[model samples]
Target: MEKPFSDYWKEYLNIQNAPCGQVGDTNEDTLNLLKNSDVVCSVRFEYRNCRTRIPVLMKMEDGYKAIYPHLSAYPKESEAQLMKINIQIAQSAGVHITSNEIIYLNKEYIRKDYLDLNEFLLRSDHLFNRRNKPSKTIDECMEQYDFDLDEWIDTVQTLLDSPEFTLDRSKKCTTGRRCSYYDDCFDESKLPDDSILFLTTSSHKLQAYANGIRRISDLEPEDIEGFKLQYAQYMASKHGIFYDKVALKIWTSMIQYPISYLDFEWDTFAIPPYENMKAFDVLCFQYSLHIEDVNHNLSHHDFFDTADCREKFILSLLETIPKKGSILVYNMEGAEKLRLKQLGEQFPKYKEQLDQICDRMIDLSKPFECGLFYDNRMRGHYSLKKVLPVFTDEYSYHQLSIQNGLNAVFTYRTFDSALPEQKQVIRQELSNYCKMDTFAEYVIFHGLEKYLKEDDVNA
Candidate 1:
């Protein structure tokens, strides 16, 4: 007969309390016991009057103290209202809940030998405890994030009762995440070619719309409020695409051969996988380098590892990249440069070489970033992927399996557990995606050069 979950947990806790006989044996035993235990892992809260249901409620208890888990690291913008609704439901059920707690995975513990539930639990401290502030309890959080319960109920009832509703286009939408229905709400395709939306630096979008300023051409110098770059972008869009030949020429002149166009793909794990690695430390798994020689010859070098390959990646880079020349990386300030700096700190033995690499590195995004280049087709985006399509149809990322950095990270992460055939496929997809980034840089460089020369000839 199988043991009841409560009994199993109680027995397991007893074993944990007992003196450790062996180092590895206790943890392994605990893990095996946990796997065998069967319990109600999920809870569904159904309201009688309300149509909505709370799908998952994580309940944590130690002795007589019980609390609901606050899962997120930071309180979300909508958390106050959501908490009020939850508290209202609890109150109606004759359950008095005073405060909420948080339970998160311990980032310090690596599952090297076996899973340690106690270690995990200890690490998953409540928000206040984690922040080292015992005085800031859940009650304080409730007070700080208080919402009007009656007003919330009224709003919910209004929403439920509404049969037909018009979209609130004028409502100031703000979020860190992209809205799915953005295209459905505001059709960018239907917008005029010279729409005020093209003004990338304009914070007065709503004001412009209100004042009947729709097109970039319609914008007066006075309307822009002394923003030279915004004015330049506006004038450029109105005439055609903007091209600063002298600025671009000077920018391109800095490119010394053998030019190494580099791109890296890395993943940030919540838990540290290796020694000296902190929680959410990035593991660089892959890199792609496209080298162009002084003789106009092109060669490619790349590295991909299924495991923690930080050391191997750096070594490969040092070997593959020539001792001399400029290293061009798109958005160097944001991605590549930061990654290199982190790597240098992680591997101090290679600090000198890494510092040299950083010294030679140049941002390929400068021209577009400085507003020296602009195309109407770019749609206010300066991303390499967006800029690439405007120049030539020769290169594209649409055909690749791993088209974006996020997809590459996800794919690489799954490689260790994947089947042999699947692993091979992931490897190829990652290589292709990273290679495209550097290759795109190469293409854009030449495209800009050709444009400059052609403009000079026409002049």
Candidate 2:
């Protein structure tokens, strides 16, 4: 059986004073054993330009020799200068040096295997040694001080004291990517006990709530009017907090709709995965649609889990969805329309059909994105995952094994690897998560509709 990397590293360290190139090896016996091996060969040389030492690997070929430079080889000129410097070092050490500065004089030696390791370790002794070595970078320092269970528990307890430690309130975190604890340090339960985020009125906007305003009804009507009615910065002096019930009436009227609630999951690419493809194509992988009927009842349609199957998926979606509905989506430009255009290019045969979907796409998110509907829970960010929790007692994906699209993609990709029984559970979980997304959209639409109808009655 092969040893794990840790075991191999420990064993390597036990060897004493092995050779010029073998790191962690301290024994001369181990060095001789390595030298006698037919499959491996190594040598050490000093470079003068930077006063660096490097190891080269040598391997045996049919009747000739080949040299593998260390991974740490510097600029071409630096290597040349170092080779010259190595010869001078060897001469000073009372070793006979050839014109080509061949020490140990292995005429037929070749280099192979562990070339990168040889270069990394042999060229710079600073990493494993302290002499002439600079301290590691912050990232490297983090690796060095790997925390244990006790240390982790202490840190978690410390974060629990701060309200800003919660996932939604992360903007208040002082360290921007600079802290070593960025990934491992966070406490989800540290959100304020009485959050003002649920309030619908504009006085409890994200900023107002942050400034210690916790309820919609508490603010004077002027505060709501300045922000909601005139879309003015109500917090500013003179312009002040003004709430106009008349303007609020008109603002709420735009909420009427043959509302189509939409959601999509997509695959983003670093490199184009296909010909004529650009980086960052939102390859639409799944979508959910929930529409309110003329009778005011809601109906839903959804697509999920495919690969190289996007073309047929788009065609089916175009046929199934209505052309002239108020297509409401949490983040329309980002999720629905962006993917539609990308798929359109791939299936030019249905370009007109796809464009039609884009034209009727009315974003439910516009009110939020334009700051018309601000929630303190969102902490200045408008994500449906955050917004969905404001109205209903339900969370969009609380029960699912995978919480968001990233986790969804990762789960979908590995679904086939599991045994049949395990796969069944995962498949059910994925379906449940996606279904909840559309259902949450339905809830938001209903809430908005109710708000509008009440405003119409008051008007």
Candidate 3:
């Protein structure tokens, strides 16, 4: 007496079109009440033997297709094993699933309008379909990977049976992410000043550790496969901080009278929120500029917007920055210059001016990155956060409400639905955080100059 699965899907589509709820809200309870609902979403299953639980499982109408949604930027390497285990669990529950599908979010979905679930599914470009089709079958994938479900289960059992498990710190395992306990496990603070881990761009970490070359001072040039930066860092660590005075002076001398230290904070939405913005297009919502004039007077300018403020941000930036000045930015190669180029392309009217800004832009991280300056406290990183603390305790980001770029992005994204008071607090926090970034650059520039002067005095 039940209606077909297609009928339920048609009803679900109709419900989705209704404007009763907010854009992102899905009436889960209403969907559950529908008859002939074969598309089981978020079905939680627990395996008693392993004491493990799978939080989400999508069972299609055919009853043989199982789908798992992976949300991370990079897929987990253990995806196949995880899917196989899920299959086993489903089979035990009398669901005979023959094929598995990974419904991954496409990086290209620009959310210009309210997310339409049906449209999202129907759009070929919205999701990466890893379904068993004519091109690649589940059986073929299993065969290629030589997947044995029993062997995988035994491996899991062995892990579970272990009395006390500790992560292996013998070698750096590339999981594309740092573990939560990374600091506790590695304890870089406890490491020697001349630890081999400080060797710049060295890939022989495991080899060095294995061969008892734990310290940079203990290493010969050959130990790190003759990497110039590694040897330079090793030498610098052995001595005090490396200060290439002549090189530093040459680099800093090129700066025009007024120096503008610039920093930008932006967010990239997987779905484009606005018309002009494409999927994955960066929305630069905020910027900070610290200007030090020819008269040695310092001034600050900044902007923050919750809405589409790209044009305003760019125009404000142009106005704030002086016509003739060296624009210093930390890691210009990675962030500032690239952003300027992207902006120039996006807004052609200001392309010439943006190009001019790009020309004047100087990467402040170059001195540290190129080994012209190296400090033991830098801990193998030339990031503004890492480098700033090394120079002076006076300017520290630890006290700020929003410390990192990622946090800023997340905070800005929540501004839409936040309470008025909360929104004000977020705006203030974002401004403070961004101001600190530009201010830190100014401080670092002065620090470098001071270091150069001191080296001259000592000489």
Q: Is candidate 2 or candidate 3 better by TM-score?
A: 3
Clashing pairs in 3: 109-271, 110-271, 110-272, 111-271, 111-272
lDDT of 1: 0.67
Residue-level lDDT of model 2, residues 208-237, one tens digit each, is 666777544445555655433123222211
TM-score of each: 0.78, 0.52, 0.79
Best candidate, TM-score-wise? Answer: 3
Candidate 3 weakest ten by summed lDDT:
120-129
Q: Of 1 and 3, which scores higher on lDDT?
A: 3
lDDT (CA) per prediction:
0.67, 0.51, 0.69
* Stretches > 4 Å off in candidate 1: 1-44, 48-81, 103-138, 160-163, 170-175, 225-229
Instruction: Write candidate 1's Cα lDDT for 226-289 as tens digits.
Output: 5545665787768878877788888899989999999998887554556556545688888999
Off by over 4 Å in 2: 1-258, 375-379, 394-396, 455-459
Per-residue accuracy of model 3 over 1-459 as CA lDDT, tens digit each: 024333333343343232221223223432342223434444434344542233223345665555544433223334556666666765665556666655333344434445443433331112222442224444444444556556767988888899977767644443456677777666778887668866666677757776888878787656666754565577677885777778889999988869999999988754445654443568788999988999989999898886778788889988889999899999987687888887886788998999999999999988888877888778787899998987899879999999999999888889888999999999999999999999999888989999998888998
Question: Could you list the CA RMSD of all candidates, in the order they appear?
Answer: 8.1, 14.5, 6.7
Query: By lDDT, is 1 or 2 better?
Result: 1
Better-scoring candidate (TM-score), 1 or 3:
3
